[model samples]
Target: MYRILIADDEPMIRKGLQKLVEQSGQSMTSIRTAENGFHALQQIQEERPDFVFTDIRMPKMDGLELCRQLAELDSDIQIVVISGYGDFEYAQKCLSYGVKEYLLKPVSKKAVHDVLDKLVRVSARQRTDTFVPVSRLEQWIAEMDDLVWSLREPELELLLEKLRKELHHYSLKLARFCDVLEELNLLLAKRLSTRDVFSLQTHLDLGGARDVEEAWSRFAEGIWSIVRDLKARRKGRAKDPVEEAKHYIEEHLAEEVSLEEVAEYIGLNASYFSQLFKQSTQETFVQYRTRRRMEKAKKLLQQPHYRITDISGEVGYADHPHFTKTFKKYTGFLPSEYRQNLGIE
Candidate 1:
């Protein structure tokens, strides 16, 4: 069982996400809500939740700052960003701060349940990830990436053994430690073929390990787990990344999304995702996004209550004239003209 902390300025959002998570049937020790990032941090320090679901826009600290600070802490708190359709671009930025998972504004039970599922699977031992501020890990990242990528077990073993011997020479300070850990996490994430970003932290206790041998064992196990999981995947057919990208695009029709952001979201190289997307859908990512936006705009235009100006923003077109031109090009009718034919002034 684990605890969860939900943070948002909107009381309704906080309450709604909390309700969905409760209904997800995940074992939870406690569930709490915070009005803003400040309160969220306070709860984080006091309750020590295993997961945090936060919104990008909040009253005091905002999700960006909250995540930035949390990224620096030597804890294993999984963060999931929640944002409105229009704020996805901003929400997407949170991924850089040691966050790999996010849910759109309209929270679904399946999304909530899926994130919890990943947490459970990764934490099978009830203790899989706990980051430490160690400097030596940074230098080994490039070499380790090659070793893990090629699945060179012997070289990998030799490297870790050498690393184990040098652990005693390292000295850690909080300020510098967090930066190193963050860098290590990001670097490893780039090399990983996992579905999304997952952290690589040692299982050793935060304060101390029983002995040097125990610490080395815990750290080595974490590294080996990556190589083993990749080996297993190589034997099986990987899931279709293009389908996942399409779903992500359909959900974020309002945000200004780029090919790179979507690629990073699903843990694929941008160039690779581009090639696969075109081969599968016969449309470039840009072409797909444009078509989706026009479709969304048409639907909004059908609603008489939604103003033309607002409709443009809803479909990700900020400049009114540009949206008008694009709408005309897509449907051969301006938004105003389209609404006019529907008999609404």
Candidate 2:
């Protein structure tokens, strides 16, 4: 039920009608009163109600004058002229001033209830026609932002379809479309403002859109671009622990670095890094380090000036004996034999 304002000179009439309207429909329906037509107009100007019921014979300004002024003020406000059977002609005159219903002086509960039902139907039609609240519009824009952030394409499609249908419910004006576009743009912009790269305003402008479909096209494209850029940025910047560990190992091959040290250097837990290293390189850390040491020893052995004993210490070995033993195992010959074989070659 709609909000109602009851206008009458008689105190009992205003109170009785207010009580009837309150009981006739819903407790939610707000009912206000005025002593005369002049006071009723003043209250309406302050705050417009959905419906007005005024007595035909009132002091200061009569109900006929109120109806006339209300027609000029807002034709949409549903008006019901109230008067006795003796003033039926006076009440009928209110019809030309946009008054539709009439309430007889001896008011009945049934009469008020019937009038409320009629007013409710008219109110329902007006609500659906072109009366979406600003708060509700903001809520819709907020939901759109949520979908965009999560990159929910399927759900976004459905939301866009819902918004498209709303286009018919409202006036098809470019200004209103621009308002929605701007609100959505600002919301996303604020959400991503802390990020280093990408700006929604630079990516798309819905101001040039001729209609709702075009505006949606531009908006969706901009959002998809942001999603793509976000995905690309994440993929490109992702750290590779194994590759970093391998590079560190290759650089410090001669140095005796433990598996735990390498894991610490790469910011990984020791036990987890051990498994990852084996999976990535197919060799334990010690095995890989020993293999690299042996390979480095062979390179030093080829250069005769760098003695085998010096190469032993250079390759992280404590003694020449250990290095020779490990070298023979790796190359199928002792370090001296490998040197001799290279000389013969």
Clashing pairs in 1: none
For 173-193, candidate 2 gives per-residue lDDT tens digits of 443454555566666676555
Which candidate leads the pack in TM-score?
Answer: 2
> Which runs in model 2 stand beyond 4 Å of their true positions?
27-29, 131-345
Query: How far is 107's C-alpha from truth in model 2 (Å)?
Result: 0.8
Residues 140-249, model 1: lDDT tens digits: 77788777766788998998777655544454333223333335546666655342323333232212232345444645676788766655543422345577788889
- RMSD of each candidate relative to the true structure: 26.2, 14.8
Q: How accurate locally is residue 279 in candidate 1, as Cα lDDT from 0 to 100? A: 82
Model 2, residue 73: what's the lDDT?
Answer: 62
Score residue 123 of candidate 2 by CA lDDT: 62
lDDT accuracy of residue 232 in candidate 1: 57
